[model samples]
Target: MTSSLSWRLAFCFTLWLSQPLSLQAQETLADWRDVPVAQLEQGAQNGVADAQYALGLRLEKGRGLLQNFALAATWFTRAADQGHAAAQHRLGQYYFDGIGVETNAQAALNWLRKAAQAGDATYLYDLARVLETQPEGKPLAADLYQQAADLGHQEAAVSLAVLYQNGTGVAQDFARALQLYEGPAAAGQARAQNNLGLLYVRGNGVQQDYVRAAALFQAAADQGLALAMGNLATMYENGFGVPLDEALAVELHQLAARKNSAKTGNLHPGWVFDTRLAPPDSSAEALERLRQGVTRGDPLAGFLLGWHHLQKTETSQEEFRQAARLLRSSAEAGYPPAMANLGLMYFEGRALPQDYVLGYMWLVLAASAGQPEAPELAVVLSARMTQSQLVEAQELAVIKGGDQLANR
Candidate 1:
């Protein structure tokens, strides 16, 4: 959403990822068109995967070479054989889409899995996309999607949430689906906000709060999500949240119809618990559910799970690190309790190094977001801080809060 490109679902391993423009990157492939074909061929045959991939890309796109899928596939395979992740991913796409290679599902799966496991988030999402096309691959696709989402792939999270909502691969757990949707939706994901609103109307997971649902629907609707517009209209017509206004409701529905076709580890500070999340029935259940939540990028669950681990004597050092990581993740997701805890932890050096300015800033964020103890704690901590440190922390907190609020 921050860029001009948008990903559209497709059978190919790639889903139209437009590369970011960068000054340095503009000098690489873009300037290498004049490289001699003989030199490129020599490098490719000698097993230089980058050359092979670049040559193949050029061939496939007819940039520096003739447009030849067969030649491109050959070059891609040569690079892929040497464990080039990008080449493997592209070869997998070629196989799936039958651009050059035969339509070999098995081959595509093999290549995609290799790329997904070895490559970054984009590869993971691409592999999941291909897997979703198979007849019995929904579960695997869903799992891969969760993995991608865990790594901050927003599209994958939305896709995985859809699977949970439909009970296609994973079990039909509305609570799970809601947990998956909340982070992305609050972050201004239009489809996520729309779908999450639908759940609220049905009372599937959290308590049915029409006011909350309408607010979410309105948010999504404002972003040009057709279904959200229709949903908001219904809420208006029924007086679910806002005052009943038939004319406004009709206008929204009409508008919707017009576009209906489109689609930290450590220990530390502040508090032990805030009682927003119910304590798990058992530690094991708690661990499992919280993990599931973490996989879905649910910050609340991540913080709760981290807190859970922090309380256990049996937790290992690696587990403590894991707890710290999850807590940091939740804090980044803008959970006030997490920010508060991280602040205190950084200040107190709980299983991590001391960072007073960071601690003060996080506490400031928590206070700004209405955490009960954060104001008092920030005031207390500010006294020990220098004027410059306080100013810097204030600036940092302001920027972070602005970004978080834009999504929330």
Candidate 2:
């Protein structure tokens, strides 16, 4: 369980295990769905494969029956011994994850191999995921992933892209990786979005575009992907494409850390490595770098330092004025979060004179730039403004290249 591999495989393994049994046995299960439990048990005892599988499913899921994993495993084994592919798949999963039986990798492999031989794409994908955890199983796993992908399994396609991206079980092929990731990413798959962002960051298959990378990371982060949030936070900390904002960066880090802590469980047996994404650096050295960036008049540095100052509980009026100026500078350069915070400051008359029209205008701009919290705040402000003020705000927002919030 200590082999070097991406921790992501554990997720894949768990996902495959939880997928509903495929429809290959749908007609048979339908026939047995309403059968009495006693009758089903008799049929299973009478060596009926479908009855055995159906009873196993009932016992395993507690559908109108008391849950019983040991009994479910016994019935699944009986059906699997009769060459029932679904039963074999379930039995294999039980062995692999030790659901009812003691964990046995070799037995799990043998049963899964038999199920996969039935040519179901899902079975092939599950087998591929299991094989992916083994040291010497990578080449075969790659082939299985390819086969499953060809059969239109999107998960397998993403796994195949990872193999191609890392050159683990296949020749290094950035183009192929990009191709595999594109469809899923375009369809708004979070993992594909994050991985594709990494590709853009590395300039692997396309020209390096930190702006595109940051945008992609933001997209995935909006979907609550902790890894993407961490990546985006790193970009902010370093001023990669978005303006640097150390306070915002720290906030994102805390948010991501909380999510990761909540979601992480005991490591799956298949998770053989500790290759989780690393957290971003926010050390003294990074502070010096930000200072240097500010000296060079980097808008990113100004935003970071300014936001940090604004968040302090005991900031002097002079510090507030400096923060407002820096935030205004960053907002004018099209930084969304800066626009958002600056708008809040103006609306609340904190750092600058109260200006409702200007505040609403900035919020509109921020919303148009995909700042998630801006639109609602803009709406809230609109409710308190006169019609003339609302119209003036819309006009100002449009002048700043933002969509009118009137129709919102």
Off by over 4 Å in 2: 1-12, 15-17, 25-28, 34-36, 265-408
Q: Pick the candidate with the highest TM-score.
A: 2
Q: State the lDDT of candidate 1 residue by residue for 1-408, as single tens digits.
A: 012212121112222212331222233345344678788778777777777877887665444333355678898899889887777878988787666567788899899888776647767877788878889999998988888899887778887888888788889888888888888997889888888877777777788888988999899889987667877888878888788888998999788766642221122233546667676545576679878999999998888888877677687777667777887899888887888888877777666677878887787777666577775566455545654565567667767777887977
lDDT of each: 0.72, 0.75
**Reference-based TM-score, model 1:** 0.50
Residue 235 alpha-carbon offset, candidate 1, angstroms? 4.1
TM-score of every model? 0.50, 0.59
Superposed Cα deviation of residue 61, candidate 1 (Å): 4.8
Tens-digit lDDT string for candidate 2 (1-408) = 112212122133432223666767575698788898899989999999999999998765544453345678899999999999988988988888766577788899999999999988888988888898888898999999999889888878889999999999899999999999888888888888888888888889988888998998899899998888888888888787889787887999888887665443211111011123232134778757867877786767767767667656788989889878877877787777778778777776766998888887787677666666665565445545654565566566656653323322
Give RMSD to native, each candidate.
Answer: 22.4, 22.7
